[model samples]
Target: ERLHSYETKRANLQAIERLKDHLISVQLTDPSSKHRIRRAVSEIGKRLSSIRNLLRDRKLELDCAVNAAENFQDDLKKLQKFCEQTEKAIQLVESATIFVPSGTDLDYVRLHEPEADEVANRLEKQWKDVFSLGEAVIDEQFGIVSFDTILEILAV
Candidate 1:
């Protein structure tokens, strides 16, 4: 199950990268052919939207699994800590930028005051949606682990 989750994530990441490359190609095309570029961009955007939805659904499943695991752990404190850390990791994955930031701390600024900055707001909004999906995927996987452990103990 964990391996499945990892593969899903890797595939999504690759799709996103390809979309970025497509966008760049559209941008660099001749101005006389701008209309064609616009059409291509529109199609790419739709595909990306679909991918985002798929990622979100996977993330929700992951979240459900994580929550179930918490109930079975013997040490509540340790379980809680693990849950928190897992959530953080998921959030980090969600917030990952398609384009690496240069010298500017774009991510930090975007997180702190996205509303005031137009560029930051756009970037933040896009990443937030993606990240939310990733978080769900992580949670569901954790839940799977919890369920498997319970089954193992019961079998004995």
Candidate 2:
């Protein structure tokens, strides 16, 4: 189960990386490429949502295990590390910029893509979903079931 969680995260990170590359490539090209890039970005946003949900579920499982254990110090540390990594991953996507044409007297360009606005909104929603799960894990740690229960459920 832990291995599955790691694989899920790896796949998500790869997807994000691919999206970043596509965005960068589009930025380097002409304005006509915006539509294609926008589509790619939208697809990436959907992938991000799926990945976040997977991670959130795994996080809950980890939280349950931690709560059931006698010592929470190490588990707490791991949780902190995971939180930091997650934040970094989100920041990576948030920091990505795309160029757009500026309509003004002065010769200037917009830094972020207008097409990405909707994608960003979707990404924000996914982030909020994952954050809610994180909050629930923290608040309901003791109430979560133990590994034995999970194993039994899996067995059936």
The 0-to-1 C-alpha lDDT of every candidate, in the order given, reads 0.53, 0.52
Task: Report the C-alpha lDDT of model 1 over 16-119, residue by residue, as the tens digit.
Answer: 65765576577666665665656665676677668767878999987985765553333334333434444454455567788433523434433433232333
Instruction: Judge candidate 2 at residue 61 and give its lDDT.
Output: 93
Model 2 pairs whose backbones collide:
none
Q: What TM-score goes with each of the models?
A: 0.29, 0.26
Best by TM-score: 1
Highest lDDT: give the candidate number: 1
lDDT of 2: 0.52
RMSD of 2: 29.5
Tens digit of per-residue lDDT, candidate 2, span 1-156: 866876786687678668766766765776656566666767876776797789789889989766645234444344344444444544555665774323331111122223233333443454346446855444344333443343242222
lDDT of 1: 0.53
